[model samples]
Target: MLGYQVPSPDEAMLIAGGKNKGSTPFRVVTGHGAFVLPFFRKARFLTLSMMESEVDERCVTRQGIALNVRAVIAFKVGTDEASIVAAGQRFLSDQDQMSVLTGRIFAGHLRSIIGSMTVEEIVTERQKLATEVLDGSKEEMARIGLGVDALQIQSIDDGDLGYIAAMSAPHTAAIQQAAQISQSQARQAAAEAEQESQRAQAEYARQTAIVQAQYKAEVDQAQASAGQAGPLAAAKAQREVLAMQTELAQRNAELRQQQLVAEVVKPAEADAEKTRVLAKADAERMRIQAEAAASHNRVALDRMLIDQLPLIVREAAAGLNGANVNILNGASGLSEMAASLVGQGLTIFDSIRGNLNGSSAEDAGEPDAPEPERPQLGDGAHPRPD
Candidate 1:
């Protein structure tokens, strides 16, 4: 085991004094096995891993102003055959000096790149400065068997000059003025809006008060009108009651007049009519009775005179026998004389009956003659006999 040698992942084995010796002496070994014998072969470790170096230097800009530039460079031992041989030849014995050599190499490139650029370009475009340094240092780094992974400009300072702040003063002042103007406009608009809101509130309050007053006035007027209604209605009721009583009294008077006509005046008039009719009927009855009596008397007297007529006729016949009166148609002539005498007696009896009836009717207190009919005033007045 003491005679054997091996290399790690970050190491490349450069074997010398063996079968691989004297040609280029570079053997890349990784993870486990670059086997070598201690007496007959030799192995050197060359790191292929990344390494970092800081570049800080004061360099003059294109304007001849000195600027302090700080940057970082990430680099590694190259993986190619030629680059590995070169790095193995150079740093295989002193691996710790790689960072020192890289820093020096990038510092020179940074100075050269800064000398070609202005302070504004260096401050504003840091990446451009880094890129220019990286490109300029590429060939020199490759010659030393190194490859750059990245280069970053960490910071740049002009030492107390305040050149960047002085350059931005005009733009910063313009921005602040714009912000102040926006704030002032916003406050003015808010004040105007608040004033308009207060005016509207006052107008609304005025209109509301007017409306409420009008409503209260109307309510009081209505209350007053309501209070006066009771007496007016009472007076109207009294007038209506008087009018009804007057109309009732008039109606009662008319009823009483109708009752008088029906019960008292009508009956009195009917009774008077009935009395007149009865008196006239009584007169007619009396007249008729008296006339009938006179007719009976005249008939009796006529019958007595008819009995003496026979005697008278007999006496005349005797007288005629003594005188010897000559008569042609003798029996016929006597019969004719007798018939003439009878007719004379009948005529005298009729005249005496008429005269006696008139005298008797007058003596009996009968009316001269009653009218044929009487006008009836009412049916209820007349009570006919059953």
Candidate 2:
């Protein structure tokens, strides 16, 4: 086995590719004969063609045909996948001009193709598009027997999507600020309203208290006035009585004059009031008696109607007979025939008074008015009942 030198993956790959890509590898062991064994057991299956070494014609690769170039390539190859391999299998040597040039051409093509692509499309559809690229590139990369040893999608530059992200930052901040401002305003308004509501409640309570106090004051004033009212009124009466006594002493003639009011004037007035009440009562009694007579007369009139009703029926019957309805259809046609009968029967009444007595019939049984009231005797409070 060749000496194993653990290093960075790039360095290890450099050692794997026979220190390819200008990677200066550290030698792990010194020379007993200073020979590289070309330990590429993993590359045993590949078809290798090597040029004859003029110094050593027998120095052919394990699966090699001799070629003009055999110089080792130093490389730390990068790819779209894992570790690198040596030239003719996974890489090309520096002195293998055809292979190196072919590699450069293929690399330029790969770089161009990969560079042309969007990283999202490359990464998101990695398996499909990447495999397609790899497959399509295989023969081209192996044009000079320099097949790709490994591949890696090491660093994908998802180019400059920061513009979209950076642009959204301000918008997000503005939205958040607007939301916070709205929320703060709402909270502030709510708080202010709450405070105002509390103030209103307090004001209402204060006003209510004031009203209650005022009402109590009014009630107390009313009670105090009520308590003083009787004594105040009695004192006023005594004062008036004293004044009246003084006035009576000062005006004896006036006192005598006033006495006439109590005797003559008051008695006359009382007599006049009593007369007026008695007259009113007598008038009312006479009116009631007249109403009673009228009622009796109405009752007599109603009684007379019973006898007259038969006479009316007889006259209507004769008229209906003249119409022949009573003989032909009888009372069944009475409603129609009765009008004719009534017209003819009216002439019978005409022999006595006819419609000329219609007015007198209305006046009959009406009561004569009562005689006017005469004087009587009573107090003036109300008229006496009958």
Candidate 3:
């Protein structure tokens, strides 16, 4: 612990006053520990960490425009033994000079590269200019045991000359015009969208009002219908009651008519029919009695006419005797006279019988039988013995 030496991760240990190898005067130890004898060896450290340097230089371009350029270089001591030895021998006495020397080295290369390019090339192609500068400084940096990781052109401007500003004027004007056009288009679109939203809100309000009005109308109609329901039902019930009463009255009228026919009309019709039958029987009995009586009277009348026939003959002879006294052919003439007188008496008897028969039929309330005609006698006479 007293004399043992170790290098930091970013540093290399350089041990002098010792036997070393390969064209070097000191022993370099990195990333490990080493033992050093007291007073026999002097151990020192060289930084191997990243370092930065900035260069600001004025140079005229190929277009003869004087431009001020600022650039940054990132460098470090190499990790190899040879590069470490070289860096330690030159910078170990004063480590702060590494940044100073690196800045001077990159500044020279920056002036040289800027001299070969125009102002436009330097401004627009900053990366190309940095690359060329880095390439041109590579071998020189390696000789001093330094390596560059990157070179960046920080800025390039013509101080107090206005050359760079003049060169960018046209592009700046075009970009400004394009931005103004885009802003105008966005404002117009916002205005149109706001108008459309207002129209949609108005339409929604109109629809809501219409729907509410329709709902109110429907509710009113329902209320009116509900109010009328009871009266309508009562009227219908009254009509039904009236219809039933009318039907009952008609049924009672029909029942009364049927009762009248059964109680009064039926008995009267039967009595009338019985009376008509009895009257017909009585008339038939009377007709039979009349016929019997008429037959008996006709028999009596015939007997009486037969009895009066001789008397009538005598009277006829007597009347003849008084009237004439002449006789011819004597006995035969007298017999002929007697026979004519008897025939006249028989005819007179028949006439009296027919008259009595017509009178009997008239008294019996029957139609009269026709009378028989009487026979007429001749005007010839003969006298007879009285």
Which candidate's lDDT is highest?
3
Clashes counted in candidate 1 amount to 0
Residue-level lDDT of model 1, residues 59-120, one tens digit each, is 99999988888989899998876788888788988977888999999999899989999888
The candidate scoring highest on TM-score is: 3
TM-score of 2: 0.24
- Regions of candidate 3 where Cα sits further than 4 Å from its true position: 1-3, 37-40, 223-386
- For lDDT, candidate 1 versus 2, the one ahead is 1
The candidates, ranked best first by lDDT, are: 3, 1, 2
- Model 3, span 130-177: residue lDDT tens: 999999999998888989999988888899999899888887777887
Error of 1 at 261 (Å): 51
326 in model 2: Cα distance from truth in Å? 9.7
RMSD of 1: 19.8
Model 2 regions lying over 4 Å from their true place:
1-250, 319-333, 338-386
Kindly give the stretch of ten consecutive residues in candidate 3 with the minimal lDDT sum: 375-384
- Tens digit of per-residue lDDT, candidate 2, span 251-294: 99787889999989999999999999999999999878866765
Cα RMSD for candidates in order: 19.8, 33.0, 21.4
